[model samples]
Target chain A: MSKNLVEFNNISKFFGSVIALKDVTMHIKKGQIMCLLGDNGAGKSTLIKTLSGVHKPTRGEIIVEGKKTIFDSPRDALDLGIATVYQDLALVSLMSVTRNFFMGREPMKGFGPFKTFDVEKANNIASERMGQIGIDVRDPSQAVGTMSGGERQCLAISRAIYFGAKVLILDEPTSALGVHQASVVLKYIVKAATSGLGVILITHNVHHAYPVGNSFTILNRGKSMGTFEKKDLSREKLLGMMAGGEELDKLEVELKEIDRTLKN
Target chain B: MSVKSKSIQNKSKDERLRKVSRLKVLLNRPELGALGGSILVFIFFGIVAGDTGMFSAYGTINFLEVSANLGIIAVAAALLMIGGEFDLSVGSMIGFAGICIAIPAIYWGWPLWCSILFAFSMAVLVGYTNGILVVRTGLPSFIVTLAMLFILRGATLALTRLITGRTQVPGLRVLIENDPIAWIFSADAFKGLFSWLGSLGIIALRQDGTPLATGVPASVLWWIGMTIFATWLLMKTRYGNWIFASGGDKLGARNVGVPVGRVKISLFIGTAVAATIYACVQVLDAGSADTMRGFLKELEAIVAAVVGGCLLTGGYGSAIGAAFGALIFGTVSMGIYYTDVDTDWFKVFLGGMMLIAVIFNNYIRRRVTENK
Candidate 1:
């Protein structure tokens, strides 16, 4: 069995009077993809934020590599080899690809006050790394805003991998993409997992998750339904649970009656 | 065998895709519209005032002198705008710093060097206040700096009157006439070159039969030097990256571990210091300081930056472009006097040029994005 890269043990988060996440536990193993499924307001964002160090859990601990750890900031989490690619991708649209790739941690050459950005090294690495993820960026100088949504996601993911992230959390990476673009991003997620990195993909789309997810954790209203291995849950059963099973069935019957009355 | 040929074909395709045309690369530059606009303005003014010595060597220097005075502040303002902040107090800082220097040296019997240092420290203090207020209070920089503008202007007026019992302080010439620092900061540069040109009848001469050897003003040299340094800073340094990122998306930059607050504070301080430099030059050259000095200059600086291709939205601009924008301003302001047009109509021309430049910039940005 692969080692668990990170484990969230009975984590709970509260905001003033509201509970964002409650007694949720999950683990991601190295070389595995964990799909976090939840609808709107299901506390999925809060859970990922805690894991990515944007928020500290109110009750519980995060174990990383067999040691209890607390992350004070996103930088702290990043230093621990955990990176999050938020939906916005944290990219400056007006900046060039190379500039965006090395925005905060730019390579510098020279000594003392004379130090300068190593543009040549940045451009070459940006282009090469992007090509590795099946994006052949023609020019590293191209502005990031000019790229397609799928390409931007690929760029963000590849950047996280290049920076030595052991566990990557992608927040709805494909929610804004078209059908073809979503497939392209799914391919990249699988590629990232194949490279021995743990990945947490957050989305409500079971169709998308069922294909690449090795394990799935479904959350509804701040509580976990269950964590299931890929072999244990079929697509139909997962969809039923996601749509609130009986509630959906009742809505379907009411919709049919309305349609018959309109026809008459 | 089929696989091998397919791999070769893919490599060729990638190579072809990477080859962009030179024209396309040039057009994609942020300063492309500014560059084109500057050239067009120069030609238009040159034709209208051609015979009136507006194109002559001496006339060129005259207009450049005007531009250089404004260019120093415009360049700094461009950087601040790129960092997504405004310093409306820049014009007021000029007036205040000049008073700080003059009242101490000319009225209080302080040494010239000591007076200059006092003025710079005051500038730093004001700059710090502006930066801290905006960052800590979460107030818009426009409102913060707007308050600073009035505060500094009123302070300059009140202080000058209280110290000297007048609005103007004179006698700076006696204090700085023999000073070496004055020669470096306030003297005319390249005097020998201009004098030699005048001797050969290439440049104009004074009525006393001597060459008009006040060649390029020292401020122009400083403008050029500062412009080069600013361009290098924006294009080559890691700090430049911070500036761009901070302006582009503050939240995104913070998420990526960029210190957005520190970057903004540093930019504010830089704009104030630039204004102080401009004040020093003006006071030393005129040999006097007035409370009304640098009135409405901040608006001109912002206009120059906008004409230079800086988006009012921030995150995109070039220092070199701002310098050219200053040049266009100086030419039109001086060129109208040489032509038969009404001098009062200069403001109309200025407004028209600014509008045209902004439209051109927008069109270029859209075209570049579409082309990609």
Candidate 2:
């Protein structure tokens, strides 16, 4: 069997009286893309938050490389090579690209008590990393606010990859992007997955997900509709299951009845 | 191969970024506005007060002494503001800290250095307390530091009155002269250089062959040194990045594992310590501590920071800019005397210049970020 980098073993999370996630079980192998398909409130965020250590699972344990592990904060997850590029992008716009690239993890030079941030080294690494992803950073000292949304997304993803992320989770990376920009980000996803890092790509766009996803996991109203391999499920079937085909059918009939009543 | 990064194919400018003009890049600098403003002020003063000897070595040093006093606090203000907090108590800290040193050195008969050390420690405690209150209670630092300002001012007045039965502690010049470390705060530097210049006839000399201007004041050196250190701290260190991040976006920075609270606390301490340094220089030079000293200097320091191009909202600013802002202030306040303008108009000029600086900064930010 291929080595599983991380396994979400029957994780469930509840927010007081609300069941945000229920009995979700999935595993990500090294070098595979696990696309998470869900609607607006389908617990995709909650599930990823659990994996990224923003929230702990109310029930069940997480196994990483065959050992049960727990995470208290996002930093803990980062320490174990789990990095999440949140939907909001978590960047300080006023800061420079190099500073944002190494916000938490800055490279230091000098010995003992006289250590300093290595600006030359940081600028080189940041620009190089972004270049690998096709972002020609003219100046690493330019403020992040000046960059396009797509470039910012690429910066975040590339930063995670550069810092040695074993598992990269991107929450709705392409939702706010334009057509060309979306394609740019999609390439980064494929690029990341092919680079041997296990990726959990969260998106509602079936078209964006189907092209790059190795397998798909569908979430509906806090319940999992099972994970499916690309070959086992056709693109049409995957979209149908992701949008909960039966629920859509029921809504269509109900809407038609309302239309007839209004006409009468 | 999947584990490795792919090579870049596109060697052109990023298509997503609009072709920004060189002018736009120049406008993007935080210090540009302040630097421009400082130049304009200097030119205006040069034209109006040229024959008044305002630009001469002696007159220049006089205004510089005033500028240095405020620049020290303003540079520290810029840092704290960048770290996303305010220290309104900075002005009151000067008065309180001086008294703290003066009471012990003169009244209790302690060593001057020991008293100076005591004052700095107290400043640390005050700064740390302010930081703790702001972070732990999640209150606005403006309000917390404002209360601190009043409390410190009132305490300084009350304590000075109770201890010595007077508002001023005077006549400590002999003691200061005797003290080993007082020269760091009180004495002028570069005396030999000035004497050499006098001998070379490059500068005006007195009957004893001493230059009209003896040397650079210790305060000026402190101002320049502190500003340089602050600029370096902001631009070249991990802590500098964290300060920008912490002020830029609290949650975003915290999510990325930046210790926002600790960074802000250290910044608060910086301002307090800067205030203590200001107090030491003044008290040592004057050979006295007065309760009325440093009144309303907080507003002046903020004005300097704001004029220097630090955003009132935090996250964006420069220490060099703040230093220039103080330069403009000192020049205008002192230059008015040489130009036959009432010193009262200094406040008017200060307000008008602050308004202009703020407008310029806002316009530049809008123009640059318009691409977004």
- Fnat for the candidates in order: 0.56, 0.65
**TM-score (chain B) of candidate 2:** 0.94
Question: What's the lDDT for residue B180 in model 2?
Answer: 83
- Per-residue lDDT tens digits of candidate 1, residues B1-372? 456434434543574474566898887777776678778878888788778888777788889988998999999999989999999999999999999999989878888888888888988888889988988898999999999999999999998898889999998998887665666568887788877888888878999756664678888998898899989989999989989898888878877788888988988888888898899899999999999998988889988888888888788888998998898888888888898899999888889888987887787666655546
Candidate 1 docking: what grade?
Answer: medium
Q: What is every candidate's C-alpha DockQ against the true complex, given to 2 decimals?
A: 0.59, 0.51
How many residue pairs clash per model?
Answer: 0, 1
Candidate 2 lDDT over A1-264, as tens digits, reads: 387899998899999999999999989998899999999899998998999998999998888888889999999899888889998787988888999999978999998766889987887799888888888886777788878999999998998888889899999999999999999999988988887899999999999999999999999998888999999989889878876677888999999999999999
Please, what are the lDDT tens digits per residue for candidate 2 over residues B1-372? 222212222343566645666777777888898888878888888898988888888899999999999999999999989888888999999999999989998899999989999999999999999999999999999999999999999999999999999999986677886788888998899999988988999878889878999999999999999999999888888898899888988888887889999999999999999999999999998999998788888889999998888888778888999999988888888888998787888888889999999998887666545443
Provide the DockQ value for model 2.
Answer: 0.51
